[model samples]
Target: MAPPLDTRSPSGPAVSTLGRSVRQAGIEDIPAVARITQEGPLRTDLDPESAARSTRLLLTHIAFERGALWVEDGVDGRIARAVAVVPGGQHSPWETVGRVVAPDLARVPPGPDADQAFRTELAAVAPRWVLSEISQGSRARPGPPTLLEAALSWARAEPGWRHGPIAVVADTDAERKAAESLGFAERWTGGPPSPWWLGVDTDPVAPGQA
Candidate 1:
């Protein structure tokens, strides 16, 4: 069996300039994480009990792997958002979950120093792929695109890993187009249509004949 995950606070310089600190979340954060998700674009219909249970399960799993569950807080110290990074195994799929920025926090472009901090911080976790479900509407909200760019930049920096074919599963043409502009490509055309998977490969030149 694999070793237990590390749920300790991430050690390094902070990565966000919006006066928000990203840190490992504990059991106490379960409710806040669930509450944030309830307000997301992909809101779940699950009841409060179910949602809390699911959140706890995800947080526990991430804690076991030395991976991280990050909570971004506002200046007043209210939890504004959360992100969980799940380590990928050789045969496992990539999965990440989190909330969009909470309403009260300021959104700032990650500076060069901040980007470096992010790269170093993420490398410590070294996930095979990073995935998040960004709401289409969030693109216009303020700082998400910059964060996405920083993520893509990190993926590009690692040559050994195929960063993508990143896919954005969306339900509309406009959302699909927005993903395209950010470098994702269409990999297929069928779905229930409520959530279409729009994807692009990180190494467009990766070997193989498709």
Candidate 2:
């Protein structure tokens, strides 16, 4: 299992000179973050309850994990955007419920019990590590450049970290163009017209970036 992350960097949470401040998210921020995700090209193929439950669980896992969930707070004190850079390892809470379909995600009860159930589920899986990617909230609110910069900064500071490819799912022409602009190439297509795009790195660490 990977050690817990140090969310408080020496440079702080990479706050921009502008009014917007990018910082690690807390449990309190999940609601706003989830709402922000709805404004994005997120998948909605599942039933509303399942979709909402999965999103909530994801945000909970990342936020409580401390370093993965990044949120850009607007001058109004509301969350303008959110991003998550999930580091792969056996201990990652994301592995518990991420990528799961409706019934699995929906079966988990809400609130604190959900966390316990997720942990129990995680314990059943064998330990393994894989490369994950930086994910952002609504493209409508703010593009990922700044938030991604902050996320990468945190990631690079982690022990044994390495530069690597980024993966994203684009559901619209605009999103596809944006991904292409950032050097991501289409890797595969999936649910709801979303195509996976991968930004390859020439000098990634051996085995994987994680």
Tens digits of per-residue lDDT for model 2 on 78-135? 7765555554443544343244111122332234544444344334332221122223
Q: Tens-digit lDDT track for model 1 on 54-124?
A: 65565556432423445556688866654433333322232232212211111222345534443343343
- The predictions' CA RMSDs to the true structure, in order, are 12.1, 9.2
Q: Can you tell me which runs of candidate 2 are displaced by over 4 Å? A: 1-14, 39-47, 62-67, 89-144, 163-192, 202-210
Per-model lDDT: 0.42, 0.45
Q: Per-residue lDDT for 162 in model 1?
A: 55
TM-scores of all predicted structures: 0.48, 0.53
Q: How does model 2 fare in lDDT?
A: 0.45
TM-score of candidate 2 on Cα atoms, chains taken together = 0.53
